[model samples]
Target: MLAVVVAVLVIYKANFPSYLYRYRLQISLSVDGQIYTGSSVIEVVWKCGPKIADSGRCGPTLDGQAAVIDLGSRGAVVATLRTGDTIYPVPHGAVDAVFICANAFGNRSTYEELPALPHLTGRRDLSPSNFPRLVWFSNPADMTSAQKITVENVANVIDSTARFTEAFVEITSDPVVMNIATKLPWFPALKLAQKGKGVLSMPGQFQLVYNMFVGESS
Candidate 1:
């Protein structure tokens, strides 16, 4: 009886509350009015509990150069080369969802949280009610020499238009759930924020917008 009880306890500890979380977040980048869908992977590191960060790999990965933006307490933004002269801004923020790289440049980065555009809704199956849409921006022209230099040095231009906006979405939720959609295979856990409420399991498709800007590089 003692052995059986111990085995049962172990099984309960291992399987209770599901032991894993899942999320999926996506962002689209628009430049000069032309839109390009950005790709990213979410990474969850155990910091007390599950904390999510950008995989540091953005679509259009370029070969020679890299750019870094300081997000202050929020964290930092790292840009990597993808295609052409584009450097994609992959923002890293704190658990609180605040932008941390305040000192990385002189000019201020602009942000906007707007309803997701209709055509960009990629997931056809999920209902629209489950997700809330938002957008953010980091204009390139407004970027200081430090910001531009880091990005330019990278062989590819950071998708300055939509710098680290997608990652911001999942992190902003009251009870943040990273990658709620299984977009990335690795991070299959939801990231809860503020200890707000119980996990939410809703069915719907939601759209988000992230618009970034950078003046034509000199």
Candidate 2:
């Protein structure tokens, strides 16, 4: 009876599958003179699901392809796109952008121009280049109620994932704050604010800060 119980426990543990969690990246973009927010999910899938081989590493290729889905509003169907290489999701309201990491082997190219999405360009704002982890976009057009709803939905999906070590926020004030944050040893930092000294002195402003602990699997 003891032997049978132990066997059952071992089998049960072995059969249990490890669940993957998603990472949420929130980017703040200026749409039609108003600041809005959006979110996207990052998923890392193993090249050989649950299979082990003698190759030093048994994880997904860091340079492999990834998917970015845009959650629509009011339970609408989400819009998704496939990236050629592993790209990070930087969700700027109205303008959703992706960032491809610099590879030691070669560099990846992206579209020089933004995609043709409604209410994206006019209200879009550019994300800072200092931190390669975060990406932002601006749209000149005013976002409709529907667009805002869709962006919020996307945020919900991203917030549910559990696969990243750090996240970023868009600080709209002075670079001093950014400089100070990066100096901290706790975690790495990324800045998504627009150019100029505009972000330097805005007190009590809604500075976008990421919840870094969200997607940790520990």
Candidate 3:
């Protein structure tokens, strides 16, 4: 009977829709055989439903891409915790598991991996670049009206994603982009925003938008 009750609860929870929960994060990266620190924001979108019957895999969906604040480099090796960083869930009672520890060049990592830079220590005790933020997981589809409103609690989340998508459409004339295009036409045309800046991208494609400080929001 105990097992049956747990199963039933899981089934009901599985029907819930997934949404992105915004959090303020602090992190450090192992860059160029040294450590760099920065403060940034992350968006962790939850999976809408529960585990598949036998897939043996269940969690927020993520691609190789992620957004980070990129705090330059540090002068010494330290294990200091970041200030004012948090991962508490909004609306309360949401369970979250941070994901990290990717290849340095892959360009992103997780906060959980710090305090014990195992990956770095493994490679002669350091690396050349690492990412330590878990921003923006892909939200599951097939949500109910209740689920829609749950995320709608904050208008900024929706607008944040919108600004990213629309950015690409207007980039041709964007001063920063235009300047980069003229100077380095072959580059990705992406840049890291200053601690107090923002990001922009093509319309409807929020994933492409990382924080950038150069342009005024349109």
Candidates in order have lDDT scores of 0.23, 0.25, 0.26
Question: Tens-digit lDDT track for model 3 on 65-133?
Answer: 122223222111111111112333322222121322223213133322221222232111112122221
Query: What is the full ranking by lDDT, best candidate first?
Result: 3, 2, 1
Q: Which digits, one per residue and each the tens of the lDDT, describe model 1 over residues 1-218?
A: 99999999877644331111112233333344444443222221111212136222111111111122333222223332121122222222111101111111111112111111111212222112221121221332222211322222222343344222222122211232223123212112211221234333223311110111100110
Task: Identify the superior model by lDDT, candidate 2 or candidate 3.
Answer: 3
Which candidate should be chosen as best, given lDDT against the real structure? 3
> Model 2, stretches more than 4 Å misplaced?
1-19, 41-53, 56-81, 84-218
Error of 3 at 20 (Å): 4.5
TM-score of each: 0.23, 0.24, 0.23
Clashes of each: 41, 22, 10
